[model samples]
Target: MGYGLPIYHSHCRIDENNQMFEEGREIIYVNASIQEDTALGRLMHDMFCTDSRDMHYEFLRKRVSYYKENEGGKQEMCEIWEEIKNKGKLEGLREGETIGKQAGLAEGKILGRQQGVIEERINSIKKLMRKNGYTLEEALDFLDIPKEERSTYIGIFTS
Candidate 1:
């Protein structure tokens, strides 16, 4: 997996937790060090997500300024700040994209999970009603299902 990139959705797949996968990329070897490196890269990559490099740059600069103010300023801190700013300029866009992709994936997973749970509940309720000798129509009425979803529930139970 290539680290420090925007993780193009066209070329990548991301899971619910924002974990990214490069499509058609095979990991033939299980190297612990590689995994660690990937994780560190991901951590750094996520810092840049937001699609706004200026925002990230300002945020980082403010953070650096805050630390310097607290420590009464140092020459070394200025050099470090410059290095950080340069690196951010070089890598922030990619990082922001990865963060955006991760956020999207996480949202999709939550929605899927919620839908799964609701479907399971609906099924269970249908079964319970059936065991009580309720017809599909009667059950739907009793459940007060919304008009939009009623047809889908009806189709499931009737079938």
Candidate 2:
């Protein structure tokens, strides 16, 4: 109903069998709590966690950290949710097999935000280079982008 709503997904054998024209499928039903220690169960647990520290896995914690630390926290996530919901409204109702658009939209949102930040940084770097008559490296250094990350910006500038 809103951005605050926790999202969920389901992929069941019954749904798969429904798509098959020919008969020969086994539909099994079994489920467990997120407290189950399996990788998938842990991952399901991670998705609902409000804090990265509460995530069941380190890799997922880093991903959540990227949102909380680098991607500008809750407002950014809400903006992404709003964008995707508005775009989905424009595309008309998605009734079934319908999972794809939302997933694609979310991925696109993340990429778009990342590209936007990089572009803003690059523009600032260029402004410094022009105004101060500094080299790309010097501008990047002045921006405090860190030496390791500067190479990609250098490549971007050169290319």
Candidate 3:
């Protein structure tokens, strides 16, 4: 006799003669399908019949529109919307930070390689000057180092 008890049948035949039981207790079945135009029927139809994402989204949109028009449950809707927005923002920031770290590491590796190459060139130039008895000007000219960049190379070699 309790409300919301499910109806079971022995066969597929559905009529006034069909009886259902739950835990050996007979349950009463009220036909709500007769009032399919009611609000509850429509809500059930949208929930059960809608299969596609767009259809479900549209159903939710209409439900929200109804709630807004009736001025019902505004506070709950606002809180849910805020939670969804904050979660999206947090996920975006996390993804952006991950991408930034990857790019920064790649750039640092490139710069480190470039520095290593420059250091190797400086060492070669210094060796040419000391072991080959070449003067600073000769070493600069032999290595094709410009006059403006000579001071930096000289400082690295001397120090």
The best candidate in terms of lDDT: 2
Candidate lDDT scores, in order, read: 0.53, 0.63, 0.57
Q: What is the lDDT of residue 15 in candidate 3?
A: 58
Backbone clashes in each candidate structure, one number apiece? 3, 0, 0
Q: List candidate 2 segments past 4 Å from native.
A: 1-105
TM match of model 2 to true structure:
0.34
TM-score of each: 0.29, 0.34, 0.31
Q: Taking the tens digit of each residue's C-alpha lDDT, what string does model 2 give over 29-124?
A: 323343457776677687778988888899879878887877565656654665465445334423212354456666555555555566678678
Model 3 collision count:
0
Off by over 4 Å in 3: 1-105
User: How many Å off is the CA of 138 in candidate 3?
Assistant: 1.5
Q: Pick by TM-score: which candidate is best? A: 2
- How much lDDT does candidate 2 score? 0.63
Please write out the lDDT profile of model 3 over residues 124-150, one tens digit for every residue. 775786589787778889988778888
Q: Supply candidate 1's per-residue lDDT for 10.
A: 41
Residue clash pairs of candidate 1: 48-96, 49-95, 49-96
